[model samples]
Target: MSRAVLWTKVVAGGLLMVVGGPAFVEYIRPSDEELRKRYNPDLQKRSAEQGERRAQEFDDYVNKLKHWSKSDKSIWYAAQEELDNKRAAIEAQRAQAKEETRTQREEMRKEMLGEK
Candidate 1:
């Protein structure tokens, strides 16, 4: 085949696929209204129940977040500050224990050498 004819055929085939692919899928798949009309009652009930449960869970989550935000500041920033405060407290305690141990060790060494 000539180069022009070959190129034309390739371009035409590509366009046909880009347009026809979605059309073919649309023709095969059922629309939402048709699917609803053919829906089973038991399945529909379960789906609705699941949706309600998810909505309730989301409400509970939001309420819990509101309860946690006692201050008028940004909730996320407040939470982060609380986390940082806890970490600082823990580090302070660790440092205090280390200092106490060092003092005790010095006392023991002085007593062993009778240095008083």
Candidate 2:
């Protein structure tokens, strides 16, 4: 190529780097906050699912209690004991669920992977 054309190509290449280099980097590199924000919808959906599961579990427990109460007095008393046991079981499950949620939150915090 002629000298002027060669110089033009070099200048064009420099201008392309100046303009496009930063844009390419910006496109590929995600900030921590941006990543977390991107995952917000997934986190919300999971939270809603967990809430629904808890509500269903509560409804099932209530239904079981109601069924247990509709029996003879002795049976009702026995059912009461069973109901107490179920309540205790539910309480334990709640505790476990809380612990699991806490653990998840902690892990997300450490990884900087959460929405909040």
Candidate 3:
């Protein structure tokens, strides 16, 4: 090919790359929601499951507490308190997870809507 034609092809190829690279990346890259769901799926279900397990544990502790003697009541009460703390911690964790998921979904929605 002539030098002019060769240079023209090179310029065209460079232009194509410059314009297409970002478009290609955007096309192939997963959206934020997709990435979140892929990495942290079943958030509510898992939280529910954890809550159920904690409830069951609390129930077991209560049952044991009922059967214990007056002398052992102190220990049982302490155990019950510990369970309460654990339940509180779990609730806090669930709330934080939900908030994070909500924030992420909101951000993704904004991105899809072309909002800044």
Top TM-score model = 1
List the candidates ranked by TM-score, beginning with the highest. Answer: 1, 3, 2
- Cα lDDT tens digits, model 2, 41-99, are 98967866797899999999889777766855565686778879999999999999999
Each prediction's RMSD over C-alphas, in Å, is 13.3, 27.3, 29.6
lDDT of 3 by residue, 29-67 (tens): 999767656655587568657978999999987776665
Per-residue lDDT of candidate 1, residues 3-43 (tens digit) = 99999999999989999899999999999778767879997
What is the Å distance of residue 112 in model 2 from its true position? 1.5
Q: State TM-scores per candidate.
A: 0.42, 0.33, 0.37
Using lDDT as the measure, name the better of candidate 2 and candidate 3.
2
Regions of model 3 farther than 4 Å from truth? 1-73
- 1 or 2, greater by TM-score: 1
lDDT of each: 0.87, 0.85, 0.82
Candidate 1, residue 111: the lDDT equals 95
Q: What is the Cα-based lDDT of residue 111 in candidate 3?
A: 96
Which model scores highest in lDDT?
1
